[model samples]
Structure formats: structure tokens, C-alpha cells
Target: MEPGARAVPATLHTLRKNIDSIPQGVQSVVEQFSVPRQQIISDLNNVSHSIGFTIHSLLKEQVYSVLEAIQGRAQDLQNSLHHLQILHKTVRTLTHFQDELGLALRDRKESTVSLLDSPHCTSCARALGKAQSLEPGADYSRVPSVEQVLKTLSGLPKANFPDLIDQGNSTFNSMPDLAVAKMAQVVQDLKDEVNKVSKKVQSIADSFPVSDYTQPLNDALMQAENKSRPYLQEVKHYEKYRWIVGIVLCSVVLLVVACNLLGLSLGACGLAMREDPSDYESRGEAGAKFLLVGVGFSFLFSWLLILLVFATFLVGGNVQTLVCKNWANQEIYKFIDTPGNLPPSTNLTQLLNLKRTLNLTSAYQECKKGAGLWDVLQLRDAYDLEDHLHLSQYTRDFQKRLDNFNLHFEEIHFLDGAGRRDLETFRQSGIDQLDYPMFQAEMQNPVVRTSLEDLARDLEGLRKIQRNITIAGRLANESQALWKIQNATVLTQEALVVKLNESVQFLSAMAPHLQLLLKQTMAEIALIETMLPVQAQRLLRHEIGCFTRKELGYFSQYLNWVRRTLTEDVASCQPLATALDNGRVILCDRIAEPWLYCLRGDLSLPHPPRYSSQAIGRGLRHLQDSDSR
Candidate 1:
């Protein structure tokens, strides 16, 4: 039992080793499902990020820039077109003035007045200068169709793609955290089970049949032994006298036997030698005398031998029946345990200085009945071995170690309200609403339908119709001024058209992919919303929880088995009782029974020596008679 107590801690250590592996088991189970789900969530986040990137590309690089560029260029075209209209009107009016100048000059003297001095030519020059000085205004009336296009583009709604992508990524990332929390719960529950099992084992260990009474009882027995020294010495002294009396009693019979055997030998030798019976020195005469002496000795010691045998029989029989029998059956302990049966100094209770009444008979009977020595010795009030087992300490340490297991994890997010809102906003962003075909058609169109340079050339042709030198010169100058304005407007509008065309081509190419990306991103969001939680739940319940329960089951079984074995099997004291029975056999059957049989034989054998002596006397006389012949 002491060895078993020592082994308990090591056994608990072994249990601890098994418990420590639970986290690894949980992780293995968690990984079976979590890894794949995590990968899917990651893929969804990538899809969301891609959608944001595509949206940004379409809005910033394709749609917004293109529309803004188109609006700016359309405004330029309107201004240029309006300026050309004003220039044409101004040029037409100048042409009319020039024509009137030519008509008036023809009617007037050819060299009578200077060309610069002519009122019509002077008026035309002033009008042309004013037309050239005219700053272009943004006239929507000149290009009503383009103004409508700009308004439509400007009215398009904006979407927050970056925020949507972040929301989706955060939502997917939080799944791993939830899974870890579930795993932590598994570990903690398993630890709780481990602690419970440890406590159970400790409880069983405490229940082991151990007591502290043995020590005090042993001390009492030792004191009794010390007190018994003088009595044991007195018995040893009496045993020496007993050996002397036994030898003296055996010698009386041996003396008679020696005389008988010698007489017989002498008588036989005399007969063989044919000795004369009358001769005093003859062997026959000596044989007769020796036989008579043997008879005399036998007659003299018969009653003494009877008395010794009778005494030995009475003493041995009484001791065997009273002492050995009682000792064998453990009944002698009763006699010794009676009050005043022994000296007070030899009393077990007095020696132990204990308040509880001590009973030697009861203690011995209890021991013979296979009660634990501690309980038989009556040490319950003196000490509690149960308190010394320290089972709670083992369980406490086990529980403390159990606390070390936990599932490792990083932060993750499930979709929150903000994320859902962002996703909805992304879904509803009106990318599909924009008319790609219309934008494409508009970009494909030139900034102006009619060439301003052609208009300027048409104005230059007006000089041919004018015969007056001043009128033709004024028309040529006006045409050159209109040509300069057209050149600048055309260059700026052409650059805007080139940028707009690139943007339109990009948007046109991305349109189908953008729609597909949006659909795919939405599908991924739905998958995360519907599938991730279920997978996590299954992992926590089926895999991790099952594994935890299995480990706990094994742990409980071990503790219960230990408890059962200790309580039922280890508690039996049958072996001790068997040993005590063997001791009884050794004392009563082997030792006392043989001594009683020997006493019986001594009583039955006394007359044989007397009879043998008489027969020897008869033999001796017959030998004398034969020798005389």
C-alpha cells in the first residue's frame, strides 16, 4: 500500500502527459475543417479586393475622367462654335460694308479720297477688330446636345469600393477567431474533466484503509515486552530444572535395563563354558547375583518412576489443554486482557498513555479477524492517516496544470453592420446604369461637326467679290484673324477628343468584366454569410467536442478503475489471517501436540522395565542350574 501510494503521483504524471496532448488533438480536429473554410474565406476576401480595384479602375480611370474630359471638351466646342458663329456674322456684316464701300468708291472719284478715309472700309476695319477682340463664352445654346451629355455624366452616383473591400476582408478574417474561441472552450471543458478525474482518484486514494494507530500500538507492545523481561527470565530458570528432572527420571529406567542386559549376557556365557554352579567365582553365580540386584533395583524405583510419570502427565496434559489450546485459538489473550490479570505497569492502555480503553483480547481478536492493524490497535483518536495522504494537493496541481491548455488564434471579424452596409452600397453603385454605347458614340464623334478653318476660308473668298482695295484687304485680315481662333480651338479640342477616346475604349472593354466581378463578389459574400458559421459550428461540436469527450471518458475510466480496485481488492486482509492460522498450526499442532504425545508415552512405558528385570532373574537361575550339571 505504501508503494501504491508512492506510485499515485507518477500515475497522475502519466495522466498529465495524456491530458497535455488534448490540445494537439483538438487542433488536429479543428484543422480538418478550419483550414479549408479559412481558405475559402480568404478567396472571398481576394474577390472583394479585386472588385474594389476594378470599381476604382472603371470610376477613376475610365468613367469619371472620361466624362469630365468629354464635358470639358464639349464646353470648348460650344465656345468655339459660338465664337465662329459670331465671327461669321461679324465677317458677313463686314462683307456687306465692303460691298457698299466698293459701290460708293465706284460712284465717287477713284483717287479723290484715301482708302483708309472711306467710311465703309473704316467701319469694316473697326468691326473686324472688335470681332477679333471678342472673348469666347460657354454658350450652351450653341451645343444643346453636348450640354445634356455633360449633365447626364455629372449626375452619376459614386461608390465607396475601398471601404467595401475592407469590410468583407474583416468579416472573413473574424471566422478564425470564432473557431479559436470554440477550440478554447473544448480545451477548458476537457481540463475541467481532467480535474474532476484527478479529484476522484484522490478521493479513492484517501479511502485506502490506512491508519495512524499502529505506531502507538507498537509502542505499547514494546513497553509490554520490556515489562515482561523478569517473568521471561524466571521461566528460563524453571526450564533448566525441568530438563534435570527429565534426565533423572529417564536414568532410573536406564539403570534397570543395563542390569538386565548384563545378567543375560553373563548367564549365556556361563552355560556355554560349562562352569560349576558351586564355585563362587563362576560366571553363572555372578549372573544370578546380578539378576537379583536388577530385580531389587526395579522393585525399589517402580513407585518413584510412577510418581514422576504421573506428575509429568498431569503437568503436560494441563498445559497442552489450558495454555497451548487457548493460545492456538487466541483465547489466552482474554485471560491476559482481564483487569488486574497483569500488573498495572504492564497494562497496554497505561503504557500508551491513551484515554481510550485498551483491550488486548479485543485487539488480538480483531487482528485474527483480519481487521487492519491500525484499527485493531485502536489509534483512531491519536492519528488520522487519511489527513496525511495529501490527495487534495495532487488534485490541485493537476487542476493547475490543466489550465495551461488553450487554442492559439489571431483576430478575425464577422460581417458587422458597417460591413453589410458597405457591401450593399457597392452592389447598388449604378455602374450598369451608365450608357456605355452612348458614351462610346459621343467619344467617337469629333469635337465640332463643321470645320472652323473652312468657315474662315469661306470668309476669305469674300475678298474676291470685293473690287474696292480697302474692302478686299479688310476681308483678308478678318479671315486671317478667324483662322487663328479656329486653329487654337481645334488643337485643344482634338487633344480632349484623344483622351476621351482612350477612356471610352477602356470602359467598353471593362464593362462585361466589371459586371462579372460584381456578381462574383456578391456570390462570395453570400457564401461567407451562409457557410462559414455552419462549418465553424460543426468543427466545434463534432470534431473538437467529440475528441474532448473521448479523452475525458478514458480519464474517467482510469480513475474509476483505480477506485474500484483500491476499495475492493486492495482492502482484503485474508492473507494476514491465513498467516495467523499458519502460526497457530506451528504452535499447537507442531510443538504442543508432540509434547503431549511424549507425556502419554512416558506414562504407558513404566511397567516394562520392572517386568524385564524379573524375567532376567528367572533366566539367571536357569543358567545356574544348567551349569551345575
Candidate 2:
């Protein structure tokens, strides 16, 4: 994280404080150092009365090159670690997914009984054949029960429900198989890459004189894994029995269906073939025996069947009513999470090895609300996660190594002692000691006593005046002599003014520095000699600070991200809740509803129509009496 903005200079300030902010701070320092370095270089040439001098920053070319190489190596290490981290996390995800996939596959295979194994299918096939044998004309309607059955069969959906489910399972299994194959290759490659990156990181860590800063981060990762191991193991243990329970329940339902189907098939077949009611060898007699046998079996097993269904209904219904519905409304958490409401062992905080209680209501609500894991779990109650991100113990050795590096400047002497003394003496000379404003005022006046151009003009005028020929000629000669003198005086005065201007400008430029240059020069020399090592030490420490801060900030961000994703996204209990709801639907809707509907149909089936000989005799006697009348 960034240092507070007010603590740092405005130039170093960042709008957001995080791992990335470190670079801005370093850039600010680099810019600050560059200004002074450039100033010193430019001003070195301007040192008065000095020659054959060179000046540069204490940071030499070789040192910069070495720093650059170190930085590159560190970056390489960071990149390797980043790749390794991604691969490791991916491997963990794939491993968890693979386990879940295998469990699902096993459960599907176990819970799904073959269509041949279901007696309902066999009985239905037999009944369908019998129905087909009946005449497709008026005879079909003679048996009203059969007519209704045919109508119902015709109305049923064309698709086989079991076959559709099997097809769906096949489609589902095929994709996972291919995906798993590709994922296997991908996981192997990722594992190999993780190893390679790990070795590379180790090599880089070894190259550093510091203790490895990555150790703490690695330990943190391991700690998280260790913490989750127990929970995963518990799930695995529970999964072992899940399919067994499903298969047992399915078998119970199938046994009952088989008995019912056998009885119905025998009774229906016998009734169709029966003709003579009094014949002992008649199929009707055999059918009546079968019906009684079926009744006896039903008497023996029906209670057991009812008991199973009732048990399931009681447990499942209550769970749906009391637990699942309340869970949906988020009310169950409050009830269960009350202190001492449930046993201590049932508390998730106890399960997770936390010292303090994490309110179930709060945890569930936060997860549902999509809060970050660190906030949801309140892991800070156990340990300070941010504290582990700091790399002071690791980076101190690196700082020491940098400090030990020889960064002393070679003794720089722009001038010998005598030369420096002479320069000082020149600075003290009366040249710049003059009253400059007075000199400037005095020098403003023209050097000539009169205007030369005006004198020349006057001479020309005198020459032009009309007079005796000899006197005019004499005046012209005198005017020419005066003009020549004026021109020479103008040139001489202009040359003198140019030289004086140069001298005055130089004096004015030097005047302010003249008072303090010697003391400053001496002080600068002394400071360079005395403070170069100390400044270098401070620079190393500052660079170390920046490096560690950036690294630690990055680690802290990573940890926070991992925590957030683990609790809020990856390890959500929503999936478990959803699975429970799905199981309820499968038990109640898919299994129980169909079974109960079949039972209703069986109970509603009509008994065969009875015909008595006595009724036939009475009808015959009545007909005889009618014929006699």
C-alpha cells in the first residue's frame, strides 16, 4: 500500500493507494535526483577560474547497469511466480471438479436401474400385446375397462421417459469424458509448468542475498489448504454412503412394483381366457388362486411399503417445510445460530478452528449478499492477514547487502589548493566591489563632450555661405578638417563605450556571488567529501524501502483476493443448498408422485363381471311361461 499522500511530496502523490502506487514514488525520487545531477553537471563548467574539470552523479554507469540487471532478474522471478500461482490454483480447481464429476457419475450409475430390471416395463409389454390381440372393431369396445386402457395408452406421450433420461445421461457423460481427457492433458502441462516456475523462482531467490520473501506467502497458501482438508475429507466420507442409500431406496420401490405388476398380469390374462365358471381346470379358477396369492403377498409387504413411504414423506416433508423453506427465507440461520440453541459442535466456527464464534446468520447473509470472504469470515479475529504480507525480515538482508556496496565517489578536485586560493583572491578583488548603480548612472552619459554629427553639419553650412572666392575656399578646407576630426572622435568614443559595457555587464553578473562564492565553494567541497557515503547509504535504504513496499503491497493484494474468492465465490454453500433442493424434488416429484399415481390406478381397477347359472335358468323358465301364454 502507498504511504499517506501528505507524508510524501506532492510530486510523489498517487490518487489511489495500492501496489501500483510504488512506481510513482520511485519515479518522483528519480526525477528529484536527476535535477540536481543535471544542475551540477551544467554548473561544473561555470566554476570561476577552473579548467579541465568533469563532474557527474555519484551513481556510476556500472552501478546503474548492475541495478538494471537486478531489477530484470527480480521481474523474471515475479513473472515466474505469477505463472506458477495461476497453474497451482487451476490444478486445485481441476482436482476438485474431477472428484465431483466422478462422484456424480457413480451416483448416476448406482441410482439408475435398468429398464429390464423394472417389472413395470415387462407387465406393460405383456398388457400391450394382449390389447393388440383384441379385435380392432366393435369387440374392442365390449370390454369397457380395456377400451379405457387403450384410450389412455393412446393419449400417453410417444417418448419413453426412461429412454429419454438415459439419452440425456449419455449426452451428459460424453461431454465430461472429453472435457476430462483434455483437462487431464491441460492439468499435466500446468503441473509441469508449476514445477518449472518453482525451480526458476527458487534459483532467483537463491541469487538474492536476502532471506526469501516468498516463504511467508507460500506458507499462507499451505495453511489455507490445510484448513480446508478436514472439510473436504468429511464430504468425501459422506459421499461414500449417498449412492448406497439411493440404491437401497430404489430397490425397495422396485420390489413393490414387481409384485403388483405380476399379480395384475396373471389376473388379467386368466380372466381373458376363462369360459366355464364351474370348471375346476378353467383359467378363471387358476386366476382366482393367483389373485388370492397376490392378496396374501400384498398383505405381507404392503405395510412395509407404506412404512418406507411414510418414513420418507415424514422426514423429507418436514425437511422441506421446516428447513429448506426457512433456509430460502434466511430465517433458519437466525434460529440455529442463536447462542446455545444448537450444540457447540454444530457451529461452523468450531468446525473451522476459529476461537471466536462466527454468527451463522451473519455469515450466510453476507455470502448471499456477496460480501468479500475476509469480511464474511472475520478471519482477523484469529490472525492479522496483512501482517504476514510485510517482508521486513526478508528484505533487511538485501538492504544490508546494498549498503555494503562501495559507492564512494573518487576524490574530485576541480582546482588545486593554490588555484582555489587564487580564485578566492580574485573574487575578493575590488573589480566587483564598486558601487554598480553609481557606475551605471555615470556611464549613461555620452563619451564625447559634444554631438559630432551636429558639429559636422555646422561645418558644412559654414562652407556653403557666399563670400570672396579665396575666403570660401579657405572655409571649405577648414570645414573638411573639422569633419575628419568629428568622424575620428565618434569612432574612438564608440569603441571605448563597447569595452566599458562589457566590463560593466561582467561586474554586475559577478557582484551578488562575489560576497559568498568562496565560502560556498569551500563548503561544497567539504560536504562532498564528508557526506557522499552517508547520502549513498540513505539512497540504498530508500530504494530498498520502495522495493519492499511494492512487493509487500502486491502480496497483500494477492492474499486479499484469494481470501475473497475462496469464501465468497469458490467455497459458497449455495451449491450444497441447491443440491439438497434437487434431491427433494427427485424423491417427492420424480419417485413418490409416480408411485402413488400407479397405486391409485391399481386400486381403481374394476373386478371381472360375474355370470350365474341360476339367473340363466330363471330367464329360461320365464321365457317358457311367456311361450305357453
Candidate 3:
């Protein structure tokens, strides 16, 4: 009977019509496929080009039909559910309004009764009595009658009396509890109708088997899995390939070693023959020819061994290229491009061409740009490279840059307890707050000044040593030339020996200067250490001075270790050179091994000596004296 209830059936009818329309649209789409497959076959026969077009059209139509059917069904279900929900909400609102109306009526009635029983009403009645008692001229008869008084007391206007009564009666008749109970009955009826419609919808939905649709999704997933599995296996295979390449590289290295050893033995034999060719002549001419043949065979075998080693490297390069290509094709390359494996790009080429047009020294400038003060500091540990060659140049450049930036070394602050303790007690620290004035004074000190002067002098010495090494290299080449001439009987053995001795003399002269430079460097280090605090020193101990007691101890130990290592290295080099001087060729080679190997193997090894713990402890004890004072 309510307006909201009246709209529910019409809404339900519309929803049902929409639901039914979905199946009708689907049936129309399905009926369209009635054009036989034979038609497609006949079209292909008439024009082969039309076959693709026909198949595409047919497949598209089927896919669109399925999509439309699913969409329509989903929309219908949504509409039906929404309609039902709205109906339920409307009923609930009406029930709530009815309850509010009943409460308002009860409240109004109770207020009226309370007002009539109040003292204010009694006072008003007393005033009416006083008006009635007035003299005849006062017109006491003008007072309202009891019926009018009762009407006023009722708090309702005369014209509204009937309407109020009707309203109260209607409200009583439509009690919220009763309305709610009636609404519940109507809701049950509506639910029964909805259930019937739901059954019909369910029956329609059941007509389409889910398995038919799920099968296609499963098939797609299976195909994707099949495609990815081979890539995964390739990754595993590439890992094995890497190991194989490593093994091959190791074998090549061994072969190179073997070849070098063989070559050295053959060269030694050649040298012996040249030294005593007359001794060989004392034997029969046939024996001399046999010796020559043996020497030739040795040279041939050495050449073949070298060629084999070279081939191994070429093969290794090829394998590396293949592996790199395979890596690029893998899924991993989608995330990261391996270094040296990038594809060529026109944009990159264009950029490079533009740089060239600008006259840019691209590679050199890039390297210079990357080189910083830290890089120079790192070079100090690189013994394999001639670090001293660039040391002063890099230092001056860095200092100039720092000056341009208006930057100077600030005092180092330690954040730990040990640092605070060391500072408070005047203990020797690693990177203590720099006393700028003291540093300036020390730099001006004759000893310190002389050390720096000597450093410059030492650098010149190093340059001289470098020049000698260059001369030695040239002489070695000349010696080789002279040896070959002697082998050809163009030069005598004595002349060859004289040239070799000259080269050796150059190397020998260069050695002492290098040793002197090393000694001067050690002396400078000592001066720096002496300038530092007596007890656990800073400065020269670590490249970066120790700031805390713990850091100081670490630096001290590191410096000591470096000092000992350098001493041992220099000491070891002595015997190596001596053995070379003694003509023990094997010993000379052995001596070169330690120096070369150490340089190559531990390229980044810290060269600075470390401070010992005992030194730090002693420093701490000395600082305690200061605290006591």
C-alpha cells in the first residue's frame, strides 16, 4: 500500500526483462554462426587470400559473442541485486518513520497532561477567578466559558481539533510495531518472488558449463610454461659452460708456463754453445752438426708451444663471445645489460660523432674527470705501477684544487669513549685535532724542511732510476742483437759479453739510487713519526692519521707490519741481485719472482706500517701522568 512498496514489482519486472534479454542477445550471436564452415572452405577455394580474412572474422565474432554474453549476465545480476537491496532499504526507512511518528504522538500527549497539572495552570485559573469577581462595570461576564477553557487547556486550536484527533487515531492505528510486523510479512512475500526469479537465473547460468571457458585459460598457462622452461634450462647450461671455460683458461696458463720453461732451457743451451764454440769444434764435425740440429729442434718445439698457447687464448675469446650472446637472449638481460654486451645504437653513434665534432678527447677527459684526490691516495698502494712517477704531480694537483675550493684539513673528532678518554688524558691518538700553528712551525723546521727538500731530491733520483731502467731495456735489446750477431759469427763472444756487462752495470748503478731513495723515504717517515706525539704517534704511521686511541693502536700495528715487510722485501732483493751478479741465472729468476709476485698479487695491500698495541698502552700510561699532574 506504501508508495515505495508499489514501485518494487515494477522494478523487479524490469530487472527480469533485462536478464531475459541477455540470453536473447546471446542466442542471436550464436545463430549468426549458422553460416557453415563449408562456406569458408568454398571461399578459400575461390580465393586463397580470403581464407585468412574469413577465419579472422569468424573467430572475432565468436569471441565478441562470448564477451557480450558474460557482460550482459553480469549486468543483469547486478541490477537484480541492486533492486532487491533498494526495496529492503525503503521498507526499513518506512518502518523507522512509523516508529518516530508513534513516539512523537506519545510525547505530545504526555506534555499536554503535564502542562494541565502544573502550578502555572493553577495560577492562570486563579487569575480567571479574580476577573470573575470584579465589579459589573469591569465586565466579568467577558471571561471565557468552561467549554472554551477546556478547549484552551487541551492545547489544540478549535479548527485543528478534528484533524488532531484523526491524526492521533491514525497514528494509534498505524503503531510502529504493527507496521513493522506487516512490513515483515510483505518482505517475506517479496523474498519468495525473488527466490523464484533467482531459480530461473540459476537455471540459465547452469546452461553454460564453466569447464569450457577454464580449459582455454589452462591451455594458455601451459603454453607459457612450456616457452619459459627452456630458458631456465639454458641458464643452468650456461653456468656449466662458464666452469668449462675456466678450466680451459687454467690449462692454457699451465701450457704457457711449460712453454716458457722450455724456451729458457733452450736459450741457456744456446748461450753455453756461444760461450764455448771452440769446445764444440774439438768434437767431430758430425757431432757439431748434431748439436746444431738439437738446438734447432728445441727452438721449433718452443715456437710450436707458443702457438698452441696463442690458439687457446683465441678459442677462449670465442667461447666468451658465445656465452655473452647466450646471456643476452636470456630473461635476465631484460633487467640488466651485462658490461661489454650492449647492442650498437644509432643514437649512441650520433652522440659520439657529435663529441668528435666538438674535438673532445673523450676517453682521456673521462679518465681525468674520474681521477680524484682519493684516487691518487689509492695509487700509493699500487707498487706494480710506478706510483712515485705521479705522486708529486697528483699531490700538487690535489693541493691546488683544495686551495681553489678554500678547503683545508680540519681537526678530526672521535665519537667513541676511547677517543674521549685519549683526548682527556693526552694519550697518543690517530687523527688528533691538528695543531695548525704547530704543523706550520714543524714544516718550517730545518729538519722537516730538509726532509721535504730531500723528498724532491729523492724524486729526481727515482726519475734517474726510471731513466736507467729505460736504458737497460734498450741495452737488453742491444744485447739480444749482439748475441744474434755472435750466433751468426758476425760478432765475437767477448764483444757480446762486453755489451751484456754494460747493461748489467747500468742496472747495478740504478739499483743503489733506488735503494738510496727508499732509505730517504724511510728517513722522511721517521722524521714524520718523530714530529708526532712520542707515545702512540699519528701522522706518518697511517696514511690517514689515527683519531682515537684504538685507531692509533690499529695504525701503529699496521705501520710496524708495513715497515717490517718493506725491510724484508728490500733485504730479499739484495740476495736476488747478488745471485744475478754471481751468474746464478736460476737464483736471479727466483729473486725477481718474489718482487714481481708481491707487486702483482697484493696490489692494494697497505704499504704503511702499523702502530703496535703496546705502543698505544704506553702512550695511554704516559697520558695518565698528565692527568695526574
Candidate 4:
């Protein structure tokens, strides 16, 4: 261990300590080399002898070891460099993050200060200043102080840092609550004012003169109340009137029942008298007269009872008529005259116009004389007269009469050979000229024209039929006369046959005695026929031959019978014509009777009876008895 050698050992010792300080796995490899220095030199000599290695190998080994050491040192330095690079990158990222956070904080602080100091913010601050200026004693608690409001608003941004905008909205929401509280306070104040007003009103009401209105109000209320009870009582009175009418009806019925009973008893007595006529005679003239008188009385009484009923009916009818007339004059007529309080001239004009326009001759005539004004006005009011005034009752009645007269005239014209022409004239003149305006205005209305036109057509048809009947009657009379002549001819033929039979029997009885005479008469007839000149004889023979042929021969016998039958027929036919003439006269009389009666208004036929004064008197007496009963 001289100086150099000692340095080597000291280097080796430091090397060994360095190798030992290496990681465990690397220390193990180093420990293997640390066995013995002598063994290490020997093994190196053996390797050198066995391979015959030179100094170059030694130098190569040394160079390889040095390269390995250098490579290891390079790897350790690279690892340390990588760790330092990672550390530098982490420090740079942390510095950059710190700078970004500081910039954001500074920007937020600057924005807060700038926004709070803006002009809009100043306006809000001024509002707060005004609130703060409020008097301390004048409900300042209700009106927020301006300084306190600004402080509260300003604190919002700091207190709710993360939700400053949201807190601003919250402050706005709080204003609604404040408004509600203000409204409530105002409402309470209004209620207090209303209460004060009510008290003042009550005091004024107490000061008013109550006595002045009290008596009049009480009187008015009492009058209204009193009228209510009377109105109810009037209704009750109307109901009582119905009962009173019923009682009167019952009394009348009772009287009628008594009258009927008396009549029946009287009728029974009359029947007994008639059955005992012989007994009445045996009882002497007095009894017979008494029975007769009783029978007469019964008849008179029955007639009287019937008359009484008739009189009662007449009285009732008259009473109903009067009542209807009164009602018409009051309710109907008065209303028509003053319809909705219209002018009287308007009503009168309407009435006259309706009468004229409806073609009601009777009503029109009455209107002309101002007599039908009431009736026409009544109808005008009842119906929508100005709009639909056709065929009111009076007008309808007049039209009915005019229609009947027209029908009768039409029948007469047709019977007199003017049917088609008259019908054409009526259609063209009368029907066509009818007030069609009334129909056009109300075409859909069923009652407007359909019924009237149908009735007119039907009446015209009836007139045509009546005319046809008249022609049929004349034809029927001619036919009947012809039939009678034919019948008479047949009867006369029968009589002629009987007479011819009688003549034949008489001739046959004389046949035996008159045979030679008959032959001589025949020879004479033949010579007389030849004795005349040719033309003369021929003429004579012709005349005789016709006479004999017609009168005697078998053919002549037929001729004679026909001639006799014709003679008898002519004679009978003559009488039939007379009878037919008489029948025609009688038929004419029958037809004319009704027509004449109708014309004269003489209702005295079987259809209309005439009562004697005695009968009338009896009837009156019976009515008196019935009424008394």
C-alpha cells in the first residue's frame, strides 16, 4: 500500500462500497465478483491460456466493461432528466392555472363594482335616498327608508353571490308582498272611512223629520193592503155568482117539471073520457057535454103547454140576443172604435174600405149609409183588417146572398138556353174580376181563397144540375106522354080483338041460312064489276076488292082487325093526350107552387103551418098555467 498502490486499494474499496450500495439485485451481481482478488486473477489467466488470448482481448474486455458502465450511467442520467422534465411540466401547468383563477377573480370584482355604480343603480340609490328622507314619525316604517333599501339591495349581490340575479328577482317578488300589505292597509283605511261616513249618515238620518213621511207612507201602505182584500173578495163574489145562477137554473127546472106532470095528468084524464063515450051519453047530455068539454080542455091544455115551452125558448133566445148585442156594442164595438186609441177617422175609413173591397153588396150599402160602420169597425179591430179584411161576418153573409142570387140567375139562364155562354161570362167577368189581390197577398193561407172559390164552383155546378133537371123534366113529360099513348094503343088492340071474335061468332051462326044468299051476293058483285065500262069496271072492282079484302077474306079479316085496332087506338090515344096534358098541368103546378111560395114569402103550405087565434089563446093560457106551477 505504497502511495499508488494505496490509492488503487482505496479506489477499489470505494468501488466496492458503491457496488454494495447499488440495488439489491445489482449488489448480488457485484458480490459475485467480490469473492477473492487472487481467484479473480487466476481465472483471468486460465481464460487467457485456454483461448490463447492476447492483450487485445484484455483491452476488448476492458473496453466492453467501460462501455457497459458508460451505458448504465447514461440510462441513470436519462431517467433523472425525464423526472426533472415531468416536475417542470407540472410546475408550469400549476402556474398557468393560478394565473387564470386570479384573472377571473379580478374580472368578477371589477364587474361587481362597476355594475353597482352605474346610472340605473344611481337612480335606484336616489329612490332609496328619497325613502330615507321620510319623516321618522309619519308611518316611516310602512314607507321603507331609502338608505335601508339601497343597503339591502346592495347586500344581495354579496349575500347571494352565486345567485345574485336570482336574489334581484326575489327582491322584486318581495315588492308584491309589500304591495299586498299596502293594499290591506288601504282597505283598512277605506273601511274606517266608510264607518265614519256611516256614522255621519246615521246622525243625519236621526236629524231628519220622520213624522212628515210616516203618515203618508202608512196611508199609502194601508190603501194598498186594503185593496188586496177587496180584490180577493171580488173573486169570491164572482164564484158566488156562479152558484146563484145554478140555483136559478134549478128553480126553473123545478117549474118545468111541475108543468110536465100537470100535462101528463090532464092527458090521462082526456084518454079516460074518450074510452067512456057511451057511458058519458048514458049519464045524460050534461055528462056528455062535460066529457066533451074535458076532452077539449085536455087538447087545449096540451097545446098550451107546448106553446109555453115555445114561448120560453123564444124568451131565452131574445135574452141571449140582447146579451150578445150588448157585448158586441160594448166590448167589440167600443174596442173597434178606439183601437189602441187610434183616430176614429182611421177606423171608419177601414170599415168602409173593407165593405167595399170585399164585394159585400149589403154591407157596402149599409156602409154607404153609415149604418154598418160599427160592425165593420168591430171586425177590423178583431182581425188584422187592414191586412186581411176580406169576408168578415157581415160581408160573408152579404156575399152568400149575392152568390145564391147569382146561382139562381145562372140556373135560369141555363134553363133558358144560355148555360155555356152565361158560365163563360161569369168566369170571365165575375170570377176573373174578383179581388185577386186578396189572394196573391196570402197565397199560402188556406182560408183566404180556396174555400170561397171551391164554394163558388160548387154552386155553379149545382146551378148547372138544376138547369139539366129542368130540361130532364120536359123530356120526361114527353116520354111519359108517348108511353101513355103506346099503352092505350095496346089496350085498344085488345078490345078490338074481343069485338072481332064476337063478330066472327055471329057470322058463323048465320052461315047455314045465308049460304045461297051469300053466293047470289057474290055473283051479283062479279056481274056488277063486268057491267061497268072497262076503266069504270076496273075502278069499281079495285075499290070493292080493297073493301072486301080488308073486311071479309082471310087476309081481309086481318086487315079489318088492324083497321079496327088502329081506330080504337086513335080514340084511346086522344084521351091519353088529354090525360098527359092534365098531368103536365099538375106537374107544372107542383113545381110552380114552391117557387111561387118562396117568391111571395107565403109560408102556408104543409111545410109552414098557420095557427088559429083560438089555438093561440089556448096556448097562451097553458103557458100561464105552466109558469104558475
Cα TM-score per model: 0.39, 0.35, 0.17, 0.18
- Give the candidate number with the greatest TM-score: 1
Which has the higher lDDT value, candidate number 2 or candidate number 3? Answer: 2
In model 2, where is the ten-residue run with the lowest total lDDT?
A: 135-144
lDDT of 2: 0.40
Candidate 1: C-alpha lDDT: 0.46
* Descending-lDDT candidate ranking: 1, 2, 4, 3
Tell me which of candidates 2 and 4 scores higher on lDDT. 2
- Tens digits of per-residue lDDT for model 2, 1-629: 01111122211111112112223332332233233333333332232111101112333332333333323322332332343233234333333433443343233223222211234332223222222221211111111121222222222223233343344334323432432342344334333433343333233213321112223323443554455455556655766675786566456445545544554565466445435333323433344444444445555655765775667567656666676567556687688767787887777655433225456666555545654334544355544544432334323443343334332323332234443454344344443445555545544654333443554454345445534444445435544544554454335444544554454555456556655654555555455445544654455445434543543454344345434443355333343233334444544444444445555463332222232446435544543453344
Span of ten consecutive residues with least summed lDDT in model 3: 406-415
Ordered list by TM-score, greatest first: 1, 2, 4, 3
Runs with alpha carbons beyond 4 Å of true place in candidate 3? 1-173, 193-217, 220-246, 253-629
CA lDDT of each prediction against the hidden true structure: 0.46, 0.40, 0.32, 0.33
Weakest 10 consecutive residues of candidate 4 by summed lDDT: 406-415
Collision count for each candidate, in order? 4, 0, 15, 4
Q: Candidate 1 on 1-629: residue-level lDDT in tens?
A: 12222333333343333333333432333233333334433433343233333323332332233233323333333433343334334333433433443343233212212322355543334333233323322221232123333333332223333443455455444444444443445344544544454444444334332323224433443455455455456656777887897687678677777777887677677767664555423776676667676777778878887776677567667767897788766787677777887887787655533336446655555545655434543344544544533334334443343334333323222334554453344334443344557655544544334444654564466566666777778667656655654564545545544554454455445445554554554455455446544543443334433433433344444444433332233332234344445545545565556657776663444454344656665765676466556
For candidate 3, write residues 1-629 as lDDT tens digits.
Answer: 12222233333343334333433543342233223223322322332123222322333333333333323322322332343233233323333433443343344324333432344332223222222221111111222112322222232111232333344334333333332343344334333433343333233223422223224433544554456455546656776875886466445444444444454454445445643554322332333334344444444444544564456445544433443333334332232233343454523323222223221223223323442211222212323222222223223432232223211112111112332232222212111222223322322222111121222232233333333454334333433432332243222222332342342333233323433433343343344234322211121122111212322233234334433332232112222122112322222222323334444464322111133446445644543443344
> How would you encode candidate 4's per-residue C-alpha lDDT over 1-629 as one tens digit per residue?
02222233233333333323223322232233223323323332333122212222322333333333323322322332343233234323333433443343344334333432344332223222222221211111121112322222221211222232233234323432432343343334333433343333233223322223223433543554455455546656666785785466445444444444444455445435644654322333333233344344444444544564466456544544443443323343344444565665656434334433432334334434434222432333433322221213212332232223210000000011232222222222211122323322322222111122232233233334333454334333433432343244323333433443343333233324333433343343344324422433233334333422322232223223323332232111122123223333332333333334343464221111133447545644544454344
**Regions of candidate 4 where Cα sits further than 4 Å from its true position:** 1-160, 163-169, 190-629
